[model samples]
Target chain A: MIPLILYDIPSKLDGTYWSDNITKSRFVLGYKGLPFQVEWVELPDIAPRMKEIGARPNKLADGEEMYTLPVLSDPNTGALVTDSWEIAEYLEKTYPEKPIFSNKSKGLIYAFGNAVISLILPAAKFPIFRASQILNERSAEYYITTRQVMFKVKISEFSPEGPTRDEHWAIIERAFNTYKEWYDEEVGKWLMGDVISYADIFIGSILSWLKRVLHDNEWEKIVNWHDGKWGKLLADVEKECKKV
Target chain B: MIPLILYDIPSKLDGTYWSDNITKSRFVLGYKGLPFQVEWVELPDIAPRMKEIGARPNKLADGEEMYTLPVLSDPNTGALVTDSWEIAEYLEKTYPEKPIFSNKSKGLIYAFGNAVISLILPAAKFPIFRASQILNERSAEYYITTRQVMFKVKISEFSPEGPTRDEHWAIIERAFNTYKEWYDEEVGKWLMGDVISYADIFIGSILSWLKRVLHDNEWEKIVNWHDGKWGKLLADVEKECKKV
Candidate 1:
């Protein structure tokens, strides 16, 4: 069997993979026991490279074209799928024997994942400096330029200190607290139940990104706030990944 | 079997029930084919009446006491459950023959419901004036006072016609579009799968509230925004409810 080709953004400084979007795809592959090899694409080359591989841009609800990373190239079928959520769906359909979304409610999980992304984005902004430090000079320049265009401000403006950072952290804390409330209400080891689902994969990937970008103390604060659930989940996913 | 008693806030003018919290319980009962009767309680009377029925104030994550409506009293088990989400869980557990949450991942659904609540709160706030008009004078006064305290502003300040209201509506429209993106991703009739779940119940209740408070044109604009999914879901829920 040919190994799947997972296209991901390479970190500038370490040449290591560190994207939440790519982590999501890696998680699903790891969970499904699918053998895959990474194809490192630089930050600036993602769009053109993905398009060269025949990966089409995903259309938003308003018909806006969105090009993103974590594009998967299935060797056996010669199928190239783009977008993390779409890749998950493709893998689930292609590998029905090992289901990521056991209940076939990927929509609900996707909704929750998007909500988490929105909640985490504000806090995630505060860690831009740390994120930039890990990027090589070229990728760092690309990252900062794109981010500035998106945020309409300098990357340094999102420093992880002072009143503004505190406000963003507070928003993130409230979002997690809201999640914890729901988690506590249900009797489950995983987000879905005793069995893990793509929701866990999505959350685990987000945590992985935070772990990569946030300082140790900052990471610990968030991990501790959710009654150790976040830490435990990352550990659980790690254990699950180790099995394959 | 004795009918379950559902305590809800009464509509001031119509002497009807219109609370989203109450609709959650009603949806469960209707879905389960359970016999239940609404015990109308005024705004100020909710806490005392619930206490009289042995429903204690719900404890928040921070251990704060919260007194809210949609309290259910099941005579068969002498169980009193407060809070909408809790009531849904109670109903599901007590009457397992007809399941509302088929996935057994109530936590995920609850998280989605809470996200919806947060997203809709801003847009929903615009309809308060219309909501107040339906309330009796006493309940209206109580509602205004409490909302003023909660929002730290006068109730009249939340009128539907203003630049601020448009901004709030834009936020809600974006939130709904985000949801529509997820909904469009999966091949399912409901938020979860082929069958309706508590998620649909929660969403439907919010729609019901909007329908009750907003003018025909305003409500239509929102209903049309989400690819007609919102309007369709409410209709589907109503059809499902009619079965009981």
Candidate 2:
């Protein structure tokens, strides 16, 4: 059987693989025990590479171009898929025996992920974009330029200090508090009880990103918050990753 | 099988019943075909009435007092429940025949509702608070005063016209767009597919409030947005309400 090809984005500086979107596909692959080979594409090469594979680009409501990574190609069927959610759905359909999302929880999981993304976006923006520092020269330049265009501010200005930093931290704290309250009420080791699913992977990807990008003290503060559930979940994801 | 009593806040001016919180309980009762009666309480009278029934008030993280309505009294068990989510859970437990939420989807539903509340709050605030104009003299005075203190602005300033209104509308549009994108991906008739659950009820309550408070034109614009899905869902909920 031909192995599945997972296209991922590599950091420009060290060529290390790091992307929440790509992590999602990786997590699903690991969880399902799917045999896959990673094809790391740098930031500047993403569009051309994706175009060669016929992977669809995400477009804004106004028809603005928005290129993204994490495309998967199924060699068995010769099918190409893009978008993390779509890829997960594809895996579920193609490999029904190991379902990433149960039928009953599918819509809820999708909605919950959307909510998590919305809540975490503000908090994650700085650290995530700042991680561009680790990218290779060309990729770093591309990343900075694209991000500046998106945020309408210089990358340096993205770093909030003093009152601004405190405000940003407070927002992050509130987002985590919201998650913790839900977790406490649900009383689950995993997001959806004992069994791990894409929901965990989705959240775990965010936690992993934070761990990678945030300074030790900053990461320590977040992981220590929420009664250490964040840290435990991160560890659980790492264990899952190891099984792959 | 004594009828459950749902305590709701009545509008000040016409003493009519209207509240998203109360509507949640009503929706659950209606959906489950449970026998229940609403006891109308005014704003100022809410805390004392809730206290009399031993309903707990929600407190902020800072331990500030934040009293709210929608308390349910189940005569069968003599149990008093506060908070819409809590009430739904209690009703589900008490009357297991008709489930409002599936076990697997409960946490996700809770999280989704929180996210919706967060996104819609800013857009809904002005019209919601402005609806206080319909309140009776004392209740209206109480509403304005409390809201002013909470928002740190006079009630008159809440009305966004011209550019401000446009900005607020833009925010609302973005929020609905987010929901629409999720719904499109999930491909659900109801939030949780064919079966209407507490999630739908929760969202429908918000829609109902918008219908009640927003100006005819304003409400029309919203309902017409998202390819009339909002209007259709509101109609569906109204149909469900009529069944009771």
Q: TM-score winner among the candidates?
A: 2
**What are the per-residue Cα lDDT tens digits for candidate 2 across B1-244?**
6888988777643337667778888888888877888798778888887788788897665887766778888888989888888888888888876676665567778888977877767766567565787666777788888888878887767755777677778878887887776566555677666777787888788888777777778889988897789989888986875523
TM-score of each candidate structure, all chains considered together: 0.90, 0.91
lDDT of 2 by residue, A135-230 (tens): 778888898898888888888777668776777788788888877766655556876676777778888888877776667798899988967889
Docking class of 2: medium
- Of candidate 1 chain A, the 10-residue stretch with the lowest lDDT total is A9-18
Name the runs in model 2 displaced over 4 angstroms.
A12-15, A60-62, A160-162, A241-244, B12-15, B241-244
What interface Cα RMSD is found for model 2?
2.1
Model 2 pairs whose backbones collide:
A12-A135, A12-A136, A13-A135, A13-A136, B12-B135, B12-B136, B13-B135, B13-B136
Give the TM-score (vs. native) of candidate 1.
0.90
Clashes of each: 3, 8
Q: After TM-score superposition, what is the CA distance of residue B102 in candidate 1 from its true location, in Å?
A: 1.9
